[model samples]
Target chain A: MLTFVVFSVRRAWQGFWRNSLMSLAATATMILMLLLLAGFWIIQTGLNAGLQFIEQKVEVVADLNDNAPADQLLQVETTLRGMPQVASVTFVSKDQALQDFRARLKARGQEDLTGYLDTNPLPNTLEIKLKNPQDYGNVVDYLDGQPTVVSQVTPIQNLVNQVVTVTNFLRTVGVVVLILVGLTVLFIIVNTIRLAVFARAEEIEIMRLVGASDAFIRWPFIFEGAMVGLFGALITLVVLAVVATPLQEFMYGFFRVLPLQFGTLVVRDLTLLVVGAGVGLGVLGSYVSVRSYLIR
Target chain B: MAPGSSTGLLRHPTLAGDRPPETTSERLVLALRDVAKTYPNGRAALRDVNLTVPEGDFVFLVGPSGAGKTTLIKLLIRDELATAGQVLLDGQDLGRLPRRQVPRVRRKVGIVFQDYKLLPRKSVWENVAFALEVTGTPGRRIGPAVDRVLRLVGLAAQARQLPTQLSGGEQQRTAIARALVHDPRLIIADEPTGNLDPLISWEIIQLLLRINEMGTTVLMATHNAEVVTALRKRVVGLEDGRVVRDEVGGAYHRED
Candidate 1:
């Protein structure tokens, strides 16, 4: 087994170097496939982060009736929390709400709201977090159906609906793009290997004549294809890292104008993105290339 | 579904004294029963040809242009299966076996083509050793096996050279070395020395005859009349796919 692996790898190495330009072309296809995938994943990650932030912080603030008692407010909290999709619940009392308003205004360098108002008009409410981004619409529907308390769930669900629609649409587009790019990679690699095989169809035919088992004949080619993938991934990762250096620095400088996560965290996440994308693309290309040869 | 289609396992036990080969009964190594091969575009390459090569024998398949000699060789090796009739190897029907099963049967046979078919990037050693390595031989055994075949084909000195750097004769010798490496019971040479001059051609034929003398059956398909007339070996003639003659102790010179 060890000998077989060694021979297989050696054949692959020789075959790879024999057609260096063709191998490079196949590798470039892999890199392009990976780059597209990585770019999509990064966008998806960013979009996911932004969506979750809004989901967690945004909620409907339903005011209670003038005659309503504290028990009724607790009942509303209990109902909202009982739903399976509700991730979390936080009830803000009127007094605590006033204190928060004052603190936020002072932080924003604004006048105190308590001094201008005769009473605490801010309604006590529960901030609801849906189980998933997909469930946000259902959460809005459930919250709007409550009428025992006074009407109106806060934070205007229309804009939230629009955001959900846009993000979902983009997610769908991302999936389609991923599949098309994957197939393009597959087609390119398969054709490259096929043309390589065609160039030596006589040798391949002779190999078949000399009692070479299909796997035996296929091993070297598959090994070559996979090594092509690995090499392509390595080169692509290098290119991505080079390109990202300036981009990351620019992002760090620009995002510094606002309070956000550290550049260090971005680097860590992007590293995962690069490696995952590269390996995935390489494996995909290798698989399609060998599959076509094996079928013949 | 031809008559007498054999599908038994080739269960010959690896008996002692089998290495250097020995004389056996006039056992037919390969039999083509009215085999016909017609291309899809309606070119008749072989037509109802009946030819049998016995074990331990050396036979030259001789014919003129459009004689279907190469096609016959291809059919025998399963490179191109016969379109109509059954091709039997050691009584196993070649047509019945699956494509995957063809290799093991092929292992019993070795073939050297006119084109040399050496992987251009592979060194001569690698070109020959590739045949052995793929058949799952142990690593330690490969060195001696390769060396023995190279010595037999007189390619031992040129083993390290790439196929591209070798002369036409040297490349053909390397191919012969590769065919001999596995010690297959049968070897097919289809116009192997077609591109070589008379001297080199004679040299290759002599080496093949020596291999045959050691009891490996050889089927060499060629159009070289000088080789046939000079060697006076068994000859099977094909014309438009039909076997015109199968004569023992035959020569190539004949009236038009």
Candidate 2:
């Protein structure tokens, strides 16, 4: 087995170099396909992250009655935090609300009309964030039930429904597009490697006639395919690495405020994804291509 | 040159004198009984072809183009299964052989083609060593085995040259060396000299006869009547997929 593996590797190395032009062509195709796949993957990841950020911002705000006691407001915050769906609940006192309204007016370069009133008209409010935006029904219902302490709850149900509908649709489309691109990559890579194998049909025929086992004829091509994949992946990664900073900058500038950072985890996952897809497609392509010759 | 004079030098260390003796002198190296083959296109390539070649026998398959000579060779190598009846090589039914066992069975037979089928990029020595390498022969054994066969085919000096660098005869000799590298029980040459001139063709025939004299069964398919008639070996004639004649000490054509 060791001898067989050593022979296969040696042959694979020689086969790759001997057919350098064909091998390079296949590698170039692989790199382009992998880059396309990785591009879509990055977009999908960013889309998901942006959608999540938007969903987290879908908070249910309830205005408390001006006369509601501090203890009641504290109790409401604790109760909201206890709920599984409620991610966090922050209570803003009337004074803090007045201050925020003044700050917003100043930032927007609008006159602070609230200063003209004899008394501050702002209401103390509870901002409730949900783990999942779709699960906002129960939290809204609970806040509405507290009629004594809460004067009114903002009717954002329609807004939440619309946001969920659009985000869900976009997510679905992203996944479907990724899948279609993945399959396209599979076929193009397979066909490219098939052409390479076709070029060596005479060699394969000679091997078959000489009583080479399917493994002997197949593994070398497979290893060669893997070599193409490895080279393609390494080259792709270098390209990606070179463009990564600018790509991230462009993404940040495009989406501006969206939390779309390519963290260490993302980098690692992308590296794994590129290498895995490159090598996997290469092996599968060669396996399927060489199978046609071996079956006979 | 004499028929058996080259046998001494062609003797394989592991396969010639040191090889185990056969169980029977009459053991059949190849047998096709009522074998019929119709390709997927409904072309009946062979029908009712019955022939047997005993161990160490030399036979010539003579037929016009499209007369099933190639189909008959395909059956022996298990390249195509007989549509009807059995093809037994060394007494094992090819039709009954499993897919995985095909390679093992193929190793028992060495095949040569008119095109020479040598890898253009590989040198003559590499081309011969390729057969053993692909068959999983040990690296240590490959060099000597390849050297022995190249020497046997009288191409040892030109082993380092590529196929295109050699003449048509040398390329065919390289192919023959590859076929012999396996020390196979049966050597099937399908129009091996089809591309060669008369003089070079005679040289190939002499080399084959010498290999046959060294105790390997040879079955050659040819359209070369002159060599076939001069050799006076067993000849099996196929016409439109049927074996019309089978004769020992036969000429390429009928004696009538």
Q: Against the true two-chain complex, what DockQ does each candidate achieve? A: 0.50, 0.64
Q: Which stretches of model 2 miss by more than 4 angstroms?
A: A2-33, A39-59, A63-124, A128-167, A246-261, A292-294, B1-25, B41-43
TM-score of decoy 1: 0.74
- How would you class the docking of model 1? medium
Best by TM-score: 2
lDDT for position A25 in model 1: 80
* DockQ, candidate 2, vs. native dimer: 0.64
- In the range B1-256, model 2's lDDT, one tens digit per residue, is 2323422212111221132223355989988877899999999998877777889999999989999999999899998999998899999999999989999999999988999999988899999998988889889999999999999999989999999999999999999999998889999999999999999999999999999999999999999999999887878888999887766667888775
**What fraction of the reference interface contacts is present in each model, in order?**
0.82, 0.78
For model 2 chain B, the run of ten residues with the poorest summed lDDT = B8-17
Q: Residue B210 of candidate 2: its Cα lDDT?
A: 98
